[model samples]
Structure formats: structure tokens, C-alpha cells
Target chain A: MPVISYIDAVTQALQEEMQRDEKVFVLGEDVGVRGGVFRATDGLYKEFGAERVIDTPLTESAIAGVAIGASVYGMRPVAEMQFADFIMPAYNQIVSEAAKMRYRSNNTWYCPLVIRAPYGGGVHGALYHSQSVEKLFAGVPGLKIVMPSTPYDVKGLLKSAIRDEDPVLFLEHKRCYRLIKGEVPTEDYTVPIGEAEVKREGDDVTVISYGLTLHFALKAAEELEKEGISVHVLDLRTIIPLDKEAILEATVKTGKVLIVHEDNLTGGFGGEVSALISENAFFELDAPIRRLAGPDVPAMPYSPPLEKEFMLNPEKVKTAIRELAEF
Target chain B: MGSEESVMETSRHEALGLSDDQVLEMYRTMLLARKIDERMWLLNRAGKIPFVISCQGQEATQVGAAFALDREKDWLCPYYRDLGMMLVFGQTAKDQMLSAFARAEEPNSAGRQMPGHYGDKRFRVISGSSPVTTQLLHAVGVALAGKMEKKDFVSLTSFGEGSSNQGDFHEGLNFAGVHNLPVIFMCENNKYAISVPIEKQLAGGSVAARGQGYGMPGISVDGNDPLEVYEAVRDAAARARKGEGPTLIEATAYRLVPHSSDDDDRTYREMGEVEEARKKDSLVQFKKYLEDVGILSTESGAELEREIGHIVDEATEYAEQAPYPDPSETYTHVYAE
Candidate 1:
């Protein structure tokens, strides 16, 4: 095992997949010559040349459409969105064409493509670059959404997403790219999708989170453990087809639930998770369900104070967990 | 003497080397499309079919462009009004009826898509969605694959005059132009996109002229003249095979009927206007041309119509009696095995 940054894991996954399958290619703005805006695709162009490592124009719809067309023709295309917020122009391609390709064609077709987009708040991305787009695409059928919080998980999930038979939206948290570093195994492996991983085990309450907020839940659990208030932190690696069994098992064991996420409260993935938990594990509840998430604001502002106020942290998670456990 | 002018004057189809039988076959496909559509509208009014999208006045453009391509090699991404194109591209009369009836045997979509949403792997006709211009990009992708695999084929995608205003259209063409892919973007400008006329739909004038911005040759052809459309598409396909970029073709026609059975045309256009356009219907004009050129006589025309009537009748009977899909199959295709 070697310690690597979150961004390196994504690059490693892309390299490994392209090497493993000759049909796989990469395309996005600055993905070739400039090595991507975040350098997540660094040096792929030099190794694969122009055909495999394509640097596309700034049109997101065209980029998405081209990838879809290629994927439909038996080519595995890994498209980059530059920024998650910029995916709106390509929304039609993803929702109407890519997501519905397999269904509309009635099993005669498949859009087995991967779309990697760096998303999250913090680092002053402000409004446009800081959006978390999982909520927008989670409702779509024939599509998969994955958000990894650590380097090891990101590497495994990216590799898995590329090989999946359906269109996968691999949302990489921008803040985690450099900040989150962990040991990634040198040997090839993939973390299965639709499975939740428990980062910490506890008996008092089950604290569910994912992406950046999963770290907060873990930190809160660690701090609570010192005071004998045990907390179980579960990271939902995939949003769609969510790990229902894991969620039910955790809720059954803890009897108290608290959900944490960076996205706004309304219509977030957490809302769906909470709904699933309540419906499946209603009888095991010890307290009313609580959520520690971003406020229902439009977006994070550039101002540090306003952003800080809007962001969730370990303190907030710890407080929510303590209150849920006590109740 | 004008050097460019030839002493011999002939119909455009004759000049394009269309044999009498082939032209008649094209005419037959167009007539079949119109007849089937007429039947669908009747079925809708009689509360038999759920919807009706007629190919009424634009049959010539559909048949002509489809005839220009190599059906076995080339790919087609047709719009909702391409009944004639689907027929020419190997989709049988029964196959269409199965779709119109939305029966389980519908190969285009397996009873999933609407009637005119064409797709068939056997004939290389790529699948399409309800969205107006996404198929344009899909066609480009087909051409891209053709280029990548070094196949001697092109992809033709058709849309209405109104859909040319979509971002997908622009993006699709821009991509095709940049890649120099073997693609022919045929814009079937049937005057009205629902209710908006061509004048209101495009402020920049001709859809063909916009091809210049994307670094491709743009052409405007008479969609009512099957010969003219065939020549335009034939030349464009040649250019694509020669490693030249895509060509934008604006085939002008008229939507003689309302947008769909659900629409009423009176609020948007006067009946007199529609009647005037109907006078230029290719169905009537092409038949008269064939008669004048001595290619088809009154007896032959009647004979062809009777043959088409029989085919449409048998297909209608088969489709109406076809089985509907089971409820359990609805969840089947959402994911792969």
C-alpha cells in the first residue's frame, strides 16, 4: 500500500482503466495537453496520444453528447465536466439520451460511460464551482451516482464505475482531492457500488454521511468515544439504489439516527436516506430522526464568514449525535 | 449559347439516373407513408389508437434522402416524421404498424417509444428519443464511429426547421465539422414547428446558410421535388466519403396537417393558407410529373395505389391484433444483465 492524494487516485484509475481496455478513452476541457484544470488527468495525453486522450472544446453539451455517441458505439468514454456546475448545458444529453438509452432502446443499447466532475464547497469556489450536483441526478433511472470521501475509495470506485454496464456519474469532491490522503493498495481492486461502509462502530447512535461530511461524522464519533458516547458512522458510497440493508442494520443496532451532508436540506440525498431508514427500520427508533446539513440557501457565498456559517463541521455532527443519543 | 445549359431537358430524377422502377418504388414508399398516416389519424379519431403523427406533406423529402444513402452501410437517425425514411431503410409496413399500435412485436422500441421514433439495428437505423435535436448528435456519433473504424459509410440525421434552433443542433454540427466526420445533417424544414412559421422560427434566414459558421457547405433544396432532395443528399454523402466535412441541407416542404392529431391548425393559420400549400403537395405533383413524362400511366398509378392499399390493409389487421407487452417486462431493460 502507498499513501496518495485523492486526485492521484482518480488519475491512477483513469490510467489503469485505459491500459486495461483499449476501447476506453478520455475527453474533456484541458484533459489532454493541459492535463485537466485540477490535473486529475495529468500525463494521460503523453502516454495515450491524441486519439485516446482528447481535449474537447468548452461546450459541455457537445462533450457529453460526443461521449454518449462513442459509448453507444462500443467505446468506453470517460468525460470530464470541468466543474460540476457547468454540467447544466449537458443535462439534456445525460438525462434524455444517456440515462434513457438502455431503457428507450429496450435492452438493445447501453451507455456504458463515466462522467467525472469535481464538486463541493470550501476553497472559495463560491456559487458556480461549489455546487453538489448529486441531488439533481439521483432521481434519474438507468444512471448511477458515486461520491467517495477518501483516496482509497475514490480509486476503487472510479475503476468500478468505468467497468459498470450503465452510465455512472462519478462526483469527486474538489476539497478532498488534495486534503484527503490515505493508503491505496498497489494491487488492482474495486470497491463495490451500492454498498455503504462503516468508518467507525459504536452502540449509542448511527450517524450516516457521505463525501466531505463523512469525515465530520467520523471525527464526531472519535471525540464521542472518549466520553463513552459511542457513535456508528456509515458512508454511503453510492447515492442511487442506496445500501438499504446497511442502513436498516445500522438503524436496528443503534436505535437512534442522525444524517449529515454538505448539500442543502431540501430534496437532498439525506432526505431519501432518512425516508428509507424510517420506512424500513421504523420499529427500532429510540429518538426522532435528526439531520445536520447545510441550510436551504441557494449556494455558498465567497465570503469566509458566511461560508463558514453555512458549512457543517465535526462540532455540528457531534452535537447532533449527542442530542439524538440522549433523546 | 450558354455553355452550362444542356440541349436535353429532363426531370430532376431522370437527370440523377433514377430508373423508372426505382423512382416508382420511392413514390410507393412516400404513398405508403401518407396512407398509413391517414389511417392512423382515422384510428385516433375513432378512439382506437392513442396518438397520430402524420408525415402528410413531407413524404418526398423523407423518401428522397433515404434513397440516396446505402441502406446496408449507412446509419439513419430519423425524427418523428420519417415514416418514409423508415420504410426505405428496411422497416416493414407491419413493423411500423406494430409500433403505431405499440404492440409487443414493435422492433423500433419494443412498445416503448412512440410511433415514429425510428430505430433498428439490422438496417443500421440508430434509435432516437422524443427530444427534437438529440438525434443529430447521435448521428454525428455514428459517423464518428464510421470514421474511427474506417468504414465506408455515412450517417444521416433529420430534424424540422424549428429544431435547427436547438443548441444540440449547433453543437452536433460544430462537432461533426471539427472532426470532419462522414455526416449529412438534413433539415426537413416543413415550414411550421407546431405553430411557428419558418419566418418566425429563424431570424438568420435559411437553415442551410448556418452551415457556413460550422465550416461546412450548406445547401437548400426543394423538398417537394424528390429528385432535387436525392441529388442534394447524394452529393453530400459523396463529400463526406471524400474526407470532406459534413454538409447542411435545408429541404423545404409544408406541414399540410396540424402538428399532431391533438393539435388544431385554425388558431394559427387560416384554412385557405393550408389549402394553397396543399396544391403543391409532392403526392399530387410527382404523380402528375410521372404521367407527363410517360413513366407512369393512369392505369399504373391506380395499380400501385391498389398494391399499397393491400399492404397497408394487411399490416393494419396484423398490428391491431398484435399482443401488448406484459407488465413485468417494463422493469427489464432499465439495466443490463
Candidate 2:
């Protein structure tokens, strides 16, 4: 087993998928010669050449729209959005075109597209670069939103997304790109798209989170264990087509739940999770379901103190966990 | 010289390499599109169908451009007003009626989308949406795939002059020109987009001339003449097949009817203007051409109209009697099963 960073896991998945299937190609700004801004597609351009690793002009809609067209033509295309914040220009393409391709065509056509966008807060990337854009697309039916927290999950889920028959929005937490490291096997294996993983098992409280915040929950769970508080941590690997069974089991096990995310709290994905838990496992609750997330401000500010106030760290997760457990 | 010019004008289709039968077929297709569109308007007025977007005056442009491409290999990403193109690409009158009726057998969307949202895998037509210019990028993507797979197929997409101002139109054409992809961007300049006239819609006053900015040749032709449109598209397809890249074509015509069934033209434009444009209708002009070429006599023209009338009548009856999709089917095809 070889330990790799989350970004390395991404590069490995692209390399393996492109090698295994000739139909799989990569396209986005600077994805070719420059290898991508984060270098997530590093060295893929040199190996696959320009035809497969296309460096497109700086137009998000075209990147998404063109990939959709090629996907309908029976090619698997992985399009990069440069940053998740820039994905708004391609919003219509994703929602109206790619998402509705199968339904509108009545199964006569489908878009096998993977739109990889680096998203999250915590870096000094201010308003434009650092943002959680998952909630914007979570409500869309035909799209599969996957945000992996670990290097292993990143590799497996990306491979699975590429092989999936429909459109998948693979969001990579930019902070976790190099920060998270884990062992990834070289063999071809996939972490199924719509499954949740219980990273730790305990009975006192349950913490549900994903992406970089999932790591925070795990760390908080470990620290809480020494304080005689047993916390169960569940990583929601896929947001849409949520693991209802896992969510119910995790919620029922501890009866106290705290959903954590870096996105704004008002209309975040946490609302959906809270609804699911309340609707299904309300009777089993020992305490009111609590949510720990960023404030409902428009975005993360540029100042470090303000940014820290908006970001969720391990200490915050630990406090949220302890408060729910004591209640 | 005057006699020589008259001789050339009489045999224009022959000079363009169109055999007598092919020109006759073009005339038939144009007439079929007109009759079907007219029937849809009547159905809409009768409260049978919900909406109708016509291809009334632009039939010549659609049929001509469609005939230039290899129907079996090339892909079409057409906009709403492309009934004529759909006909030439293998979509039958029944297919159009099924869509108009929003029936379960509708090949375009199975009653999911409204009529005029054309798409069918069997015809190699890429599905389109209500957005103005999104299909341009889709066509470019299809051409990109053709180039990548070493296939010699070209992709053609059409839109209104109003759509040329859309960012997608710029983005699609720029991408296609940059890669030298085998795609054709055809702009059916129908003088108005909904209610906005071309002068208000286009800043430069010409959609075809904008092609130079994207490194492609832009050509404008008479939209009422099928032979002219055919010649332009044929040359453009040849350029695309030779890997010479895309071409921008502007077929100038008038929208003889209002934008849709819901729109009332009297409020926006005068009847005199529409009646003037109707005089240059492609069906009338093309029939005279066929008559001059000694192909279609007055009796034959009447016979052709009767033949098309029967097809439209049969299609309408079949679609009207077709079943609606089961409610359970609404959940299917959102994703792969």
C-alpha cells in the first residue's frame, strides 16, 4: 500500500481511467500544458497529449457544454471548472443541458460527464477562490454530487464517477487536496457513489459531515473519547441520492446528532440532512438536532480573523460534539 | 449575352449539380414542411395543441442546408424553427405530430418537452432545449468527437440572428474555430427574434460578418432560394470535410407569422409588411422554378399538395389518438437505471 495525498489520488484516478479507457479524456483551462492550477491533472497532458488532455479557452459554459456534447456522442469527458466559484457561468449547462439530457431526450441520449471543481474555505483564497458550491446543485435531480474526505475515497469515488453512466459533479475540497493523506491501493476498486462511511462508532453522540470537515469530525471524535464521551462520526461520501439507511442508523444509534459543514447555515445541505433525520428518526432523538456551520453571511471574508470565524476547525467540531453529548 | 443569362437562369439547379429528381424532392420537402406547419397553426388555433413555432418562410433555408450534409453520418443540432431540417434529416410528419400532441410515442422527448424541441437518436439529431444558442456548443462538441475518433462526419447547427448575440454563440464559434472542428454554424436571420427586429438585436447588423472574428469564412445568401442555400452549405460541408474548419452562414428571410401561436403580429408589425413578405414565400418561388425547369406542371403541383395533405392528415389523426405516458414513467430516465 502506498500513502498518497488527496491531489495525488485525483491525478492517479485520471491517469488510470484514461489508460484503461480511450474514450475518457480531460478538458479545461490549463489542464493540458500547465497541468491544472492545483496540478491535480499533473503530467496527464504530457502522457495523453493534446487531443485527450485538452486545454480549452477560458469559458466555463463551453467546457461544460462541449463535454456534454461529446458525452452524448459516446465519449467520457472530465471537465474542470478551474474553481467551483467560476462554475456559475456553466450553471445553465449543468442544470438544463447535462442534467436534463437523459430526461429530455427520454433516454435516447445521456451525458457521461465528470465536472471536477476545487471547492472549500480555510485557504487565504478570499471570496472568489474559497467557497462551498455543493448546495447550489444538491437539489438538481439528475446530478450526482460527490465530495470525498479522504485520499482513498477520493481515488475510488472518482473512478466510480468516471465509470458511472450519468453526470457526476466531483467536488474536491481545495484545503484537503494536499492536507489529507492516506493509503490508496493501486488495484482498480471503487467506492460506490451513494454510500456513507462510519469512520468511528460510538453511542453517546453522532457527527455527520463530509469533505474536509469530515476529517475535523474524526479528530474531534478521537479527542472526545478521552473525555468519556463516545462520539460516532459518519462521512457522507455522496450528498445527492443520500444514504438514507446509513443516516437513519447513525442517527438512531446515538439519538443526538450534530451536522457540520463549511457552507453557510441558512440554506446549506445540512438542512436537507436535518430534514431527513427528523422525518425518519425523529422519535429516536434524545436532543433537538443541532447544526454547526458557517454563518449566513454571503461568503468568507478576506481578513484572517473573519476567515477563521467563518471556517470550521477541529476545536469547533469538538465543542459542538461535547455540547450535544452533554445535552 | 442576355439570351445566355436567360438560359443559365432556366437551368440553375442543373448548374448547381442538382439532378431533376433531387430538385423535385427538395420542392416536395419544402412543401411538406409548409403544409405541416400550417396544420400545426390550425391545431393551435382550434385549441387542440398548446403551442406552435413555425418554419413558414424559412423552409427553403432549412431544407437546403439539410440536404447539403450527409444525413446518415452528420449530426444536426437544430433550434425550434427547424421543421424543414427535421424532415430532411428523417423525422417524419408523424414524429412531428406526436411531439406537437405531446404523446407517449413522441421520439423527441416522450411528452417531457414541448413541441419544436427536436431530438431523435435514429435521425442523428442532437436534442436541444429552449435556450437560444446552447446547441451551437453541442454541435461543436459533436464535431470535436468526430475529429477525435477520426470519423469524417460534420455537425451542423442552426439558430436565429438574435441568438448570435448570445455568449454561447461567441464561445461555441471561438472554440470551433480554435480547434478547426468540422462544424457549421448557420444563422437563419428571420429579420426578428420574437418582437425585436434585427437592427435592435445585432450591433454590427450582420451575423455572417462576425465569423471573421472567429477565423472562419462567413457567407450570406437568399433564404428564399433553396438552390442558393444548398450551394452555400455544400461548399461549407466540403470545407469541413477537408479539415478546413467551420463556416458561418447567414440565410436572410422574413418570419411570415408571429413568433409563436400565442403572439399577435398585428400589435408589433403591420399586415402590409407581412403580406409583402408573404409574396416572396419559398414555396411559391420554388414552385415557379420547378415549373420553369419543366419538372412540375400545374396538375403535378396540385397532385403534390394532395399527397402532402394526406400525410399531414394521417399524422394528425395518429398523434391525436396516441396514448399519454404512464405517470410512473415520470420518474424514469432521470438517471441511468
Candidate 3:
């Protein structure tokens, strides 16, 4: 076992997949020679050369569209979106083109593409940089959205995404890239998509989250353990094709539930999770299903105090968890 | 009328390296597309089909461009009006009929997408959607894949003149030109993007002239002349296969019918203008060229028409009787099984 940063785990997955499958290649704005803006695709250009590791123009639509075309042509392409907020320019290509490729083509054609984007707020990245865009695409049926909270999950889920038959939006929480480090197996392994993991098992309360907030929830659960509050933390690694069975089980384990995320409260992914729990496990709830998320402001602000107010931290998660547990 | 005139007419196809039978086949495909499109319009009028986007006036360009490609190796990302292109690339009248009827057995979308959203893996035709010019980028991707793998294949994508103004048109073409991918961007400038005429659709008033900014040779051909389109596409394909990069082709023609079954051309344009455009119909012009070159006679042309009529009739009957998709399978294929 080797301990690796979340960003290194991403690089490992890409490198191993490219080595394992010759058809697998990478393309994006700075993915090639510059090794990606975050260095997530670092050294891929030198290893795979210019053809395989393509440095594309500044157009996001072309980045998405070209990856789709290559995937349809039997090539596995991993396209980087630089930042998740910038993915709007390529929204049509992803939502309309990549997402609907298989369904619209009557299963005759499918796009096996992985669109990687670094997302989340904090570290002072304001309006243009920080965004939780997964909710915008969660409603789209054909797309699979994966947001991992650890190095191990990132490695396995990304490998699964790249090899998956359909389009997968692999969202990396930029805040978690360097902050989260965990032991990952040096050998080949994969964390399956659409499955939720109970990171901390308890019976008093259930905290479900993904990405950076998932880490905060885990830390909150650990600190609350000293106070005789048993909190169950579930990491929803894959949002789309959500692990409904796991969600139900987590809710049943503890009747009180608190869904946490960094996205806005209204129309956030927490709404869907809350709806699923309420619809299926209505009687299992000991308290009203609560959701703690960013306020419904347009986006994250640039000022430090305002940014902190907008983002979810361990302190916020601890308070939300204690409130749910006591209720 | 004279022997010298006959020789000149025959030489025109020969100079393009087209044999008599091949030229005749091109004519037949163009006519078949026209007949199919005409039947679809009738079906729409009679309420047998839900919609109709015609290839009536642009068959020459579609068929000609398709004929110039290596049918076995090349890929196509054709628009809704590329009926002739689909036929040349291996889509049958039965397939088109199934698509038009939105039957469960249709190869395009199995009743999911609207008719004319062409796609068939067997023939290497990439799937398309209603948003125009997006297929251009998909075609470029296929070409990029081919180039990356060192494969011998070119991708051709077609769109309407109105689609040329789309941001995707700029993005797709700029990417293709930058990468020098083996793709052909053919703009079927039928002079309208759903009733907005060419003047309003194009800022420069020319689609081909925009190719210069993308570093590709752009050419405009008469959409009514199948031979001219064939020659231009053939040269473009040669350049693509040689790694010289993409070519922008503008084949100017008229939209013989309304944009779709839902549109009313009478609201936007005069009936007399449409009637005038019909006189220069590619089907009528190509038939005359074939007859003048001694490849077709009155009897042969009539026989071909009768054969196409029988095929369309059979296709329509079969599609009408084909079953709709079962409700139980509505959620299938969203992801791989």
C-alpha cells in the first residue's frame, strides 16, 4: 500500500489506464505539455506524445465534441474541462451529444468518454473558479456523475469511469486534491461507480455527503464520537445512478439524516437525496430530513470572510450533525 | 442532336474518371432520393408520418459527395436532409422508411429520435441531432481518431447554410483546421435556415469564403450539377487522405419545400419563387444530362422510375405495419447493459 494525494491518484489512474489500453488518450487546454493546470495530467504528454496527449484550443465545446467523436470512432478519450465552472460552454456537447449518444442512436453508437473537471469552492477561488456543477447534470439520465472524497476512491472510480461504456463526468474537488491523502494499493484496483460507502458506521445519526463536504462530515463524526454521539457517515462517491439501496440502508440505520454539500441549497443534489429518502423511507425518519448547503447566492464571493461563510467546513458539519443527532 | 455534341457530353464524365455505369448509378441515387423525399412529403400530408425534412432539391450534392468517398472506409455525419447521402452510404429505402415511421426496428434510433437523424454503425454513419453544425465537430473527432491510430479513413459532415452561423461551426472548423484532421465540411446552402433567407443567415453572403480564415481551400459548386459536386468532393477527399487537412465546400441550391412538415413557406416567400426554383431541380437537370450523354433513354428512365416506385411502395407498406417499441423497454440503452 502506498499513500498518495488525491491529485496523484488521478494522475496514476490516467497513466495506468493509458498504459493498459492503447486506445485511451487525453485532450484538453493544458493537459499535454503543461501537464494540466493542476498537474493532474502531469507527465502524460511526455509519456504518450503529442498525438495521444492532445493540447486543444481554448474552445470547450470542441474539447467535448472532439472527445465524443473519438469515442464514437472506438477510441477512449479523457477530456479535461480545466474547471467545472467553465463546463457551461461545452454543456450542449456533454448534455445533448455525449449524454444522449447511446439512447438517441438506438444503442448503435455510444460515447465512451470521461470528462474530468476540478470543482469546489475554498482556497479563495471565487465566482469563475469555484462551482458544484454536478447538480446541473444530475437530472440528465444518460450521464454518470462521480465525485470522490479520497485518494483511494478517486483512483478506482476514475478507472471505472474511463473504462465505462457510456459518458462519465469525473468531477475532482479541487479543494480535496492536495488536502486529502490516503493509502492506495499500488496494484490495479477499481472502485465501482453508483455505490455509496459507509465511511463511519454508527446508529445515532446519518450524515451523507460527497467531495470535500464528505471529508468534513467524516471529521465531524469523529469529533462527535467523543461526545457519546454515534454518527453514521456515508460517502456518495457516484451521484447519478445513485446508490439508492445504500441510501435507504443508511437512513434506516439512523432515523435522523443530514445531507451536506457545497452546492447551493435550492436545486442542489441534496434535494434529490432528500427526496429519495423521504419517498422510500418515510416512516424510518425520526426527524425531518435536513440539508445543510451553501446559501442560494449566485456563486462564491472573492472576499475571504464571505468565501468562508459560503463554504462548508468541519465546524459547520459538526454543528449540523450534533443538531440532527440531538433531534 | 449531332454526333459532336454527343461526344462532348460523354467526355464530361470521362474526364472526371467516372465510368458510364457509375455516372448512371449516381443519377439513379439522386432520383431515388428525390422519389423517397417526395413520398415522405405525401405521407406527411396524409398524416401517415409525423414529419418530413426534404432532400428534394439537394439530392445532387448529397449523392455526388457520397459517391466520391470510399464507401467502405469513410465515415459520414449527415444532416436531416441527406437522404441521398444515406442511400449511397448503405442506408436502404426500408431503413429510411422505418426511420420516417419511427418504428421499433429502425436502425437510426428505433423510434427514439425524429426521422432523418441518420446513424448506422454498419455503414460508419455517425448519429446526428436537431441542433445543426454539431455533427461537424463529431466528424472532426472521427478524423482525429483515424489520424491518431494511423488508419486510412476520412470523415465527412454536412450542414445547412444557416448552420454556418452557429458557434459550433466556428469551433468545429477551427479545431479541424488546427489539427489538420481528415474531414470535409460540406455546407448544403439551400438558401434558408427554416425560412430566414441566405442574406440574413450569412454575414459575408458566402459560406465558402469563410474557409480562408480556417486555413482550408473553400469552393462553391452548383448543387444542381451532380458531376461538379462529385469532382469537388473527390478532390477534397484526396486532400484529406493526403493529410493536407479539411476543405469547406458550399453547394448552393434551393429548398424545394418548406423546412419541415410543420413550416409554412407561403408565409415567408412567394409561391412563384418556389415554382421558378423547381425549373432548375437537380433531378430534372441530371436526367437530361444522362439522356444527352447516351447513358439513359426515355424507356430506361421510365423503367428506373417504375422500379423506384415499387421500392418506395414496399418500404412504406412495411414501415406502416412495423411495430412500435414496447413501453417496457423505454429505459433501456441509457447505459451499456
* TM-score of each prediction: 0.97, 0.99, 0.98
CAPRI quality band, candidate 2: high
Q: Interface RMSD (C-alpha) of each candidate?
A: 1.2, 0.6, 0.6
| Better TM-score candidate (1, 2) | 2
lDDT by residue for model 1 (B1-337), tens = 4424653666556779898888988888899999988888888898888987878999999999999998878888889999989989888889978998999999988999988887887887767888889888888876776777678798899999999999999999998988898999999999998999988999788999999999999999999988899999999999999988799999999999999989998989999989999899999998987887678899999999999889989999999999999988788888777
Off by over 4 Å in 3: B1-10
lDDT of 3 at A229: 92
Candidate 2 per-residue lDDT, tens place, B37-115, comes to 9999999999999999999999999999999889889999999999999999999999999999999999999999988
Arrange candidates by DockQ, descending.
Answer: 2, 3, 1
Tens digits of per-residue lDDT for model 1, A1-327: 799999999999999999999888898899999999999999999999987888776789988888888788788889999999999999999999999988888788778899999998887889888888898999999889999999999999999999999999999999889989999999999999889898888899999889999998988899999888999888898887589899888888799999888888998888898898788788899887888888899988889998888888889888998888778
The CA lDDT at B275 in model 3 is 93
For residues A152-271, write the lDDT of model 2, one tens digit per residue: 999999999999999999999999998999999989999999999999999999999999999999998888889999999999999987998999999999999999999889889999
lDDT of 3 by residue, A73-93 (tens): 999999999999999989999
Pairs that collide, model 1: none
> What DockQ does every candidate get?
0.70, 0.90, 0.88
lDDT of 2: 0.94
Each model's Cα RMSD = 2.2, 1.2, 1.3
* Clashing residue pairs for model 2: none
lDDT: worst 10-residue window of model 1 chain B: B1-10
